[model samples]
Target chain A: MQQTRTVELGTGLFVFLGVVALFFLTTQTTGFSGFMGGDAYRVTARFDNIGGLTTRAPVTMAGVTIGRVEAIEFDPERLNARVTMRIDGRYDQIPDDSEASILTAGLLGGQYIGLGAGGSFDNLRDGDEIYLTQSAIVLENLISRFLFQQSQEDQDD
Target chain B: MSVLRELGESFVSFLRILGDMALFLLRLVMYTPRGLLRFRLVVHQVHNTGALSLVIIMISGLFVGMVLALQGFDLLARFNSEDALGTAAALALIKELGPVVTALLFAGRAGTALASEIGLMKATEQLSAMEMMAVDPMRRVVLPRFLGGVIAMPLLVAIFTAIGIFGAWLVGVVMMGVDAGSFWSQMQANVSGDEIFEGVFKSVVFGIAASLIAVYEGYRAWPTAEGVGRATTRTVVLTAVSVLILDYMITAALL
Candidate 1:
């Protein structure tokens, strides 16, 4: 009977540890925690092309993540990608004129939104749209453009 | 004509196997409620399958984590982005390796044991004796073991992931002198709740598949020593392949 009790206790402990691991896995790996209750405000930005800017991409201000991309949709009339972002309530000091640009961490890393502070006292409110936006850089387009320019120069020569 | 007949026979046999497995699964689901009343038996099987399997799971997790850290470190060093090693290792383990490896290991270790044990009991006429005595072996025997296995699997996978992450930390930070703070911070910035949910959900599915296949193979094994051996082997093979296939399907659908 004691042995059976021990086994049961062990099973309980094993399950507890598993739950702890799961807690760590969720909190440590992800930006949000259970305690946060998602206290964030949503904002929107329009870009000519989002490129590989996936949903849930981080929104950073001065290298620190202040929000995340919540959703991405295409606006039919404007022919641009509409990106919805959820900014943490604590970082509400961002100016309305600030620029939101899609950027990669490295040359071949994941995409994120980099916010550049603008020279203004006007604070961005909830559901406010950022007008100044830059889309993701396409390397192929830049390279091809460069090659096309070089070929034109050679033809002139 | 003979070749076509052989093909037809094989196809019929395959359909028969599927039908038998489906009925067996239905019986299992029906008997589960009755089996839950035998709580002591379930506890005993949990002790046997889960508690006993912990050691192997931990060892494998640690090793897999260490190797991931080593490879990640090597690859990241090329671009001077060694600080991202932690993120890479953690993502690989939690998202993919942890649950899949744990399921594969569980199938080989506990799954085989469950199958062989049932097969042996069948061969010895134990199930038939219980039937003759007006007892349902499906409830008294098979269901508890299956339930215990299903309960234990996710826990084992969780432990594997935890140990594997620790192993990565040990190798990357302690052994190789990577900046521990950056490693952890990068991981926090990159990983999300959806990814962890995917991992856990995948393991739960794998657990059900592994446990059900193991018990079903054992219960249906022919009443002979060779049949028991074959059943155990089939339990391992079928569980492994199905786990991989399901993992792919789930990953494709979810990610």
Candidate 2:
């Protein structure tokens, strides 16, 4: 009986440790803070090209993340890409005229939306769309353009 | 003609074993509810399988994580993006290595023990003795151990992953000159809930497969010393191959 009790206690401890580890993985390491629906408000932006922007990518202001991209869809009516972002409720003072731009993190890192605050007195609210938006810069387009300009310069010479 | 006949016979035997395993699994599932009633026995088996195997799991996780950091740093330094080490290491550990490695270790540690123990009991006629007294050996013996393994597996994987990340942090931040802030923040920013779910889901599937194979092999052993030895060996070999194959299938399906 004593041996059985000891075994039971040890098993209980092991299970408890396992649960703690799981909690840490989900909450701290992965940064999953449960459902985001209630604590955040949605805003929309339109860009000419999204260029590998994925849902759940960070939405940052001055390099500090304040929200995440909730959805990306093709705007067939406008012939552009529509992006929906969920900004944290605490950051409710974003100006109505703020510029939203898709930017890459490092030279080859993933892309995220970077928001530049505008000076307008009006604050953006949920369901509001930012009209001033910049699209993602495609590397291939930049390279081809640079090559074309260099060839033109050589021809002139 | 003789070689073709031999190949056909082997194929038929393979199908026969597969069908037998399926029937055994069905019987095991049917007895599971009755086995739950004997919860104390299940807990004891959990202690035997889970707690007893904790040290090896932790040590192995630490070493694996350390190696990943060392290799990852060297590879990423060429690109001048060593700050992404945390994200790289954490994602690999959480998405792939954690569940797969832990399952392999579980097969080697607990699976063999369960197989050999049950095999020996059959060898000595202990299981038959219980049957003579009207106790269903399936419920009294097999189901508790299986349930214990299934319950303990996710927990073991979770612990292994967490320790692995810590080991990476120890090497990348403390020993190496990588920036500590980026090490953690990069992981938090990039590692999502879906990847963690994938790891947990794989662990559960692996747990069921490993446990079921171990008990099935032991229950159907030949009731002799040589038979028991062979059963234990088969349990390890079968569990390892199936876990890896299942890992690939699950990853492909999830992706």
What is the i-RMS of every prediction? 1.6, 0.9
Off by over 4 Å in 2: A35-37
Report the lDDT tens digits of candidate 1 across residue range B31-125: 88878888888888877788888889989999999999999999999999998898899889987999899999999999999999999999999
RMSD of each: 2.3, 1.7
State model 2's lDDT.
Answer: 0.93
The residue pairs that clash in candidate 2, if any, are none
Where in model 1 is the C-alpha error above 4 Å? A119-121, A145-157
lDDT of 2 by residue, B1-255 (tens): 999999999999989988998888898788888788888999999998899889999999999999999999999999999999999999999989999999999999999999999999999999999999999888889889899999999999999999999999988888888899999988988899989999999999999999999998999888999999999999999999999999999999997
- Candidate 2 fraction of reference contacts recovered: 0.81
For lDDT, the strongest prediction is 2
Q: In candidate 2, what are the lDDT values of residues A16-118, reduced to their tens digit?
A: 9899999999998876466465578999999999998999998999988889999999988999999999999989999999999999998757899999999
Give lDDT tens digits, candidate 1, residues A1-157. 8988898887777777778877777767666565235678888999998878998888999998888899999999988999999899899899999999999987557899999999889999999999999989888888999999999999999
Residue B66 of model 1, lDDT score? 97
